[model samples]
Target: MESGLAGWVQTIGYIGIFAVVFAETGLLVGFALPGDSLLITVGILGAAGKLQLFPAITALFIGSFLGNNLGYWLGRWAGPGLQRRVRADHLERTQLFMRRFGALSLLVGPFIPIVRALVPFVCGTLRMPYGRFLPLTLLGSLIWTVGLTLFSYWVGSKIPNLEKYVYLILLVGISAGVVPAAIRFFRRRSARSVEM
Candidate 1:
């Protein structure tokens, strides 16, 4: 994911941070996006004197916190009716999974791509209380945001010439993220075309 946006990642500054972190926590599609990497990238840039690590980290933390909160509320309000109408067996699966893994899912869901968004929605649909999720949400956000931010700074600093060609690294990161999916998408499309 960072490969795709490595160059732009460092140069684009706060805008990138806002987009990645917010999408990661708030949007279901963002599960695949590189919130962790972006933070690390930001830190790396800061360590190299290209960007400020503190502000980047702060923005990331706030973005993550708000994103999760928004997602949680969206799910809480969205509920089973939304699920039923949007019905696919996916919702049923969400319900079943929640019965067994609701707490764990809430804690760990943010790490996964598709599941992250769905889990929170499931929690809301299943009526998991906000009191139960509030602390957990904050904890998860901290773990994800701060931990990665520091790691990126440490790692970025150690690497040779990472800052020299930030764009290439960003491209590599984004390519790493989308290439597999693109391959899959094309394969599926080709398969469908053949069928027709």
Candidate 2:
């Protein structure tokens, strides 16, 4: 799955990067897509003279911003109905988190693959004011896309095994996101048990 996606991006170049990032963040089915890996690969390619770094990063920033906006609207349209039928505990947790730290979540969510895709939708469903959401979303998108792209570009420039290590970087990135969420989940569960 990883290599195939990388190959496709390699074949299509910057446009592919923009599309994949857009889809992964904007669309639900895109949750499984290799976003972090793709970004790293593109950065490596930029370093290799295969792609233009400036334009590619620019497109990535725009694509992510637009994708999150689309997701937010999509959530507004469909999230309410889905939220009603979903389990209550999950809903309560999401709502509580959103209420307490929505801006921070919006700012940081893009770096975490799963949360990247879902945060915009949830914010929309909860009717978060767009005025507040937009600035944070833009800032987060800028940081995640530009920061990773530049980091990978630097690594690719310095490393010989760009392809081999891109996956490792992605593994660390994914783990970074998952570990925190898992810790939170366990803490929440323990608190509930104590209350009981």
Candidate 3:
């Protein structure tokens, strides 16, 4: 069942991968998509010779960068009106993340799932200078796309018949990306309750 699922993912090809990455990073509706797992799977496929490594990496990077730009502009266009529509707690958390991290948040955001999608929009709403946002976002996208892809590729290449364990790899990748966010959320909730 797992191999079959991985096979299906491989069959989607580069364009499908690109679309997933683009929507996951750009659109608010994409929050639930498995961006990290997809990237790792792409890397493993590349190692298994099921996909071209260079083009896959290129497509992933382009999709992420462009998607972030789309989110930024959308936020800019919607302005404060968008903020009102968003859950107040989510907006507040995003704002606090930006405030605590400043510009570094753009670079780090790609590693955090929901934050990856929201930070650019928040920056846009705040009118972060394009000159600054562009390069940082570009760097972040590159680091995220290339780093995960290559690491997974390397692992696939090293392990004999690693493709058989794709599900395990995916589980690890998803956990790595999600566990920290969950911890942070629970901690924050506890802290808030203490205050109240």
Best by TM-score: 3
The global C-alpha lDDT for each of the candidates, from Candidate 1 onward, is: 0.69, 0.78, 0.85
Candidate 2, residue 195: how far the Cα is off, in Å: 10
Q: How close is candidate 1 to the true structure, as a TM-score?
A: 0.68
47-121 per-residue lDDT for model 1 (tens digits): 677777788887887887778777767777765455554347555555566677658776666554455556766
Q: Which stretches of candidate 1 lie over 4 Å from their true place?
A: 1-4, 81-101, 164-196
Q: In model 2, what lDDT does residue 174 have?
A: 74
Better of 1 and 2 by TM-score: 2
Stretches off by above 4 angstroms in model 2 are: 1-5, 82-100, 172-196
Candidate ordering by lDDT (highest first):
3, 2, 1
Candidate 2's residue-wise lDDT over 1-196, tens digit each? 2354455666776677788788987875455787777778778877866678898899888889988998888888898776565456645655565677757988777776566777888888878899988998999899989999899899888977565555667678778878998999999999999999
What tens digits encode model 3's per-residue C-alpha lDDT throughout 1-196? Answer: 2356468667777898899889988876556787888888888888888778999999999999999999899898996876776677767777888899999999888887677878989989989999999999999999999999999899899987777788887777668757987999899999999999
